[model samples]
Target: MSYELQALIGPAELVAVAAAEVPAARPRLLAQGLALIPATPEFLAAFRVGDEATAAPAAAVSPSGTAASAGFDWFPGGLERRLAAWSKAGPIACVEADYFGGTGTQRAAVWADGRLDLGPITSAELEPFPPEGSPISRALRRLGARVTEGDDAVRDEFDAVGLGAHRATVSWVSAG
Candidate 1:
């Protein structure tokens, strides 16, 4: 099954905390890391398409599965972590999280310090919005980051197990 989460935070400082806190729990809890994506929109988009040629394949998933030929799983939480930091520097149009797998798919989008117009979203009618003054929403704004919706990366690693995105965690090491 797929799993996704998104949040927005502000005032800068807390971004680091969220980065360390959110992703750290997941991969460590599952004992499996996820594929890493760069913070830039272009890179993020290329990652979705499994277009390593254009994007930085820093810690990319292998074609086979989560187990890199070298035996390491790239952490998926990096994107979230990066956004947490990036947003602190400027006003981001949006923040998002996404996951797509054979069993299911998940996506989240968020906006902080501004109102979100749900009319344009893909599943806007079916989507849920955080109420104003809600603790979570407030906390995120205070932290300088907010979670939001987005789409899942393309399924590249067909041999992956469990969640599809997990497959992108796979890597292959070259031996000299």
Candidate 2:
């Protein structure tokens, strides 16, 4: 399985967190404001963000969207990177996406204040965004901000934008 992730990070610290935590991978530039990071299955299995274990399941956004029933661990190295990079940015919003098991996709939107909305956009509603970008990239770009993917060496590239960092939070959901 392969998981592709796209995040709209708000607050500079959140971008730092994502940069630090997001597994090393090459991302594609979807537009001026969006980037897509693809991850290996092993990394996906170890992904976890703040308060995720205690987070409640979010409602399904589409027929295929479902709440996650179990907890998963974030890789130690990734988690440490996030903590180490915490800093200040203006308020920022993020959309974290994951795709696995063929057509299945899952998504969550994290707010700087620690609220998270989890689910996937309806496939029909996501037609304009190509596979190269994923639905989240399109949604983030629509906000009229600029986003880009960083290479392995510059994962914290988003932090340079001065957007405030969020108090990381995640709500897990599944979609097919």
Among all candidates shown, the one with the greatest TM-score: 2
Worst 10 residues of 2 by lDDT: 167-176
| Cα lDDT, model 2, residue 37 | 33
Q: How far is 159's C-alpha from truth in model 1 (Å)?
A: 15
Give the per-residue lDDT of model 2 (tens digit) for 1-176: 54444344333334444545555423333323433332334334344335453222322111122212111122222322232233222223334434445554434332222222332333332344455344343334333344445544322223323211221121111210
Task: List, in order, the clash count of every candidate structure.
Answer: 23, 19
Candidate 2 residue spans exceeding 4 A from truth: 1-17, 22-30, 48-112, 117-120, 124-138, 141-176
Best by lDDT: 2
Q: How well does candidate 1 match the true structure in TM-score terms?
A: 0.21
Q: Distance (Å) between predicted and true CA of 57, model 2?
A: 12
In TM-score terms, candidate 2 sits at: 0.32
C-alpha local distance difference test of each model: 0.29, 0.33
